[model samples]
Target chain A: MAEHDALTRERILEAAEDVLRRFGPQKANVVDVARALGVSHGSVYRHFASKADLREAVVRRWLEGVSAPLKAIVAEEGPAPQRLKRWLDALVTTKRSKRVSPDKELFAAYRALFDESGIAIETHVGELARQAAAIIEDGIARGEFRPVDPDETARALLDATTRFHNPAHAEEWSDPGIDASYEAVWRLVVAGLTV
Target chain B: MAEHDALTRERILEAAEDVLRRFGPQKANVVDVARALGVSHGSVYRHFASKADLREAVVRRWLEGVSAPLKAIVAEEGPAPQRLKRWLDALVTTKRSKRVSPDKELFAAYRALFDESGIAIETHVGELARQAAAIIEDGIARGEFRPVDPDETARALLDATTRFHNPAHAEEWSDPGIDASYEAVWRLVVAGLTV
Candidate 1:
């Protein structure tokens, strides 16, 4: 019975994402999600306290999916340069496919998380950036990347990647084009401080 | 009499920009503008045909203002490398201070322009980019910048500047810190492409 409940929860979460992608967040309601799952609305309520609770779950799921690859890349033992490349690739892919719209409901969720004392976007992104910076700092120590301020370098790297991935700018790049573009970025990083 | 007419038109255009910036596009109505300016709404109609006409004047004013310095940089006969650096500095400075908030009714005006034609946002930016590319292409010809695809190099340069200017990413940079950051960017661009 516990396993069946968990399965239904997963089904509802998947349906929620589908609704979000199709109708955007504002229109993605409990009824729509249940209809998508061919289940009764009561079943959704059994899993979630309310629509807000379910939406939060969907958002949390999206955030986890987005960051998982970064964690995996960081965990692997490799040279920092290669690790950075993999991280960039992962970031681009994630940003491109992740939530494509800034609907009002989506903005509200971000605002809610931002207002919460325990949840902050900066903290989440900063922690990942610091980890990436540590890798670059190590690379500099090993004479792989140029010797520059790791924090600043990490920020620039992230900034460049962010602009590249933003939907407003994504149309400017194709998948293959982005790969080669990063090559220019890599060369710039290496040239600035490489011995 | 003609000079006085031009002054009233200029005043109305400035007033429109101020209203849009303050209240966003929806509230930037002719009635509101008249109330703000102590003029009859009918008087505004005497100078401009409609809100759409006023918005076009405002956008054109903004584009011309932003592009003016870059134009001067290009017009001057000098080494391509020197001109490129000056152009970038001028471009970034212009973009950083002059931002069009999404709240501005100008967005709808831009949308209307798109509907009338197929011109896209990137293409709009691309026109300015091609102008900047000319400087880089000249540098390549003179063996200042590296011999690469000038258009791609141009896009990358604009991409860097655009990211630097986006208001959402404003916290990513500090005014005092941005110059150093841009220097780092310049180093990267030079390293990757400079011959």
Candidate 2:
């Protein structure tokens, strides 16, 4: 019964994502999700207390898809600098793909959901920062990075790359010179971290 | 007669600002601006081609108010690093003030105008980048910094500090630890430039 309940909840969330992609955050509703799942709206509510709760869960799940890979990079054994660079590269690639993907409508829907879902965003940012700090901590232990506060430095690193990954700057990401510009910034960041 | 035309144009822009402050970008119109100035909408149209043009001009003026002080800092005869820091500090202060000022309605109105006025924003960003590049060029010439591409490096510097100045991150600016975070990023930036 527990496994069945869990599977039902997962199926409901999947239907919610499909509903969001079709109708966007402003138009998507629990009823639409329920209709998509072929379940009653009350059944959907049993899994998610309210429309807002379900939307937040959908956003959380999408964000987890972004961070899960970064978490893997953080856990890898390597020089901190290389791992940091790879992690940042992965982040930029993921964000850019979301902005300019073939499924732009779906991405736009998720972007709207992301903008309104504040708690989900905060949790995602915190998790990303923790992963970055783990890499920095390892670097410090290996004497490969400057002895800075790992958590603080990790946040700084994230802030320094804001233009590349931030949704607000998504429009600028498509510029022809954006990759070169990101490389310049990356070089500067590496120097700051090392020198 | 030309002077009179210029005065009339200036008056229309001022009235437009007043209308925008009260009604916000969505509800403000040329007719409202004319009403505020005790003139016909035709008189306002004589000065601006369309409502969009007048709105763009207002946004341009507001952005100039932000960039003008930084331009002065750029023109000052000082160490490049110090000038760069001062320029960035001035920018942060101005952006923060606009975000947290008592006149939130006015700011919100202007923020909407800014978001939509693509040409105005692009021009403002370009001008600011030119000023930053000037300082970086001077730094390299004085043997105070590395011989990096001044324009590229300046762009990187601005990009790195996006969180502090970008309007999207305005909510995060009020955090108590924000200044420390800016300082930390600034230090990293300066290291990248110097070392």
Candidate 3:
């Protein structure tokens, strides 16, 4: 019974993701998710107690895409500087794809939901910053970066690259020559971080 | 008639700003502005052809408060590094005050207006970038910084410090110890810009 319930819950979440992409967050509800999964409303309720609870779970799934891959890069690497550069590129690519992806509606829905719940947003950012701090720590120990406060330097680096990574600057991401501009910013960042 | 017309137009704009702050952009129509000014809707329309024009004007006025004062600081007499630091601090201060002020509803209304019309936001950003570039050029000329591309470097500096200035990060702005984080970020920025 436990195994069956877990599978059913995962199936409902997958269906809910599909439903959210089609209808924005405001309109996507438990009923629509159940219909998509070909399950009764009572079955979805057995899995997720309320629509709010289901939306939060969907947000967690959405966040995993951005959080999981970057954490991996930070842990597995030949050199800290190389890992940091790749990490920056990964962050920019993740944000850029989400902004222009076919699931842009889903992206909007997730942003709206996350905005309503500050802890989720804070936790997501805190995780990213923590990952960044780890890379900075690696660089310092290897003598690649200056011996600055790792936490502060990580936040600075993140803020510096925000135009490429932050959702608020998403529209500017599509501008002509934005790639060159991004490279210019990246070069300055690497220069700053290097001793 | 032209002189009186100019005075009447200015009066309409002042009243429109008041109405926008009190009622927000969506509901602050020409009629409301006219009522605030004790004038007719036709009078407001005579100055602004449509509701869009009126909203755009209000956005421009809101931007001037942030842009105008800072431009003078860029031209003030001081070491380029000191000027740059002050400029960075001033931008953050302006944005923070706007976020927490009792007129925060006014701030939200302006953001909504600018978001709908990208031109307003772009113009505001372009002007600020120009000011930063000027400060960078001064730093280079004064032998205080390396021979990097001033325009590109200025952009990098602005993007790096965005957490302090951008409205999207407003929630994080209120975080405990945020000011110290901002200063730490500022130190890294100055270290990067200086020779």
Model 2 segments more than 4 A misplaced: A1-8, A26-31, A40-52, A100-102, B1-8, B26-31, B39-52
- Candidate 1 wrong stretches, greater than 4 Å: A1-65, A74-83, A100-119, A134-144, A165-195, B1-12, B18-24, B27-50, B76-82, B99-124, B170-180
Candidate 2 clashing pairs? none
Question: Which predicted model would earn the best DockQ?
Answer: 2
Worst 10 residues of 2 chain A by lDDT: A1-10
Residue pair clashes in candidate 3: A160-B160
Quality of model 2 by C-alpha lDDT: 0.84
Docking class of 3: medium
List model 1 lDDT by residue over B113-166, tens digit each.
434333343445676778778988888888877677787777776665556754
**Model 2 C-alpha lDDT per residue in residues A7-93, reported as the tens digit of each score:** 476788888877777777785678888777666788778788988888888888888889998889998987999999999999999
Q: By lDDT, is 1 or 3 better? A: 3
Question: Among these predicted structures, which one has the highest TM-score?
Answer: 2
lDDT ranking of the models = 2, 3, 1
**Candidate 3: misplaced stretches above 4 Å?**
A1-9, A26-35, A38-53, B1-9, B27-35, B39-54
Query: Distance from true position, residue B64, model 1, in Å?
Result: 1.4
Best-performing candidate as measured by lDDT: 2
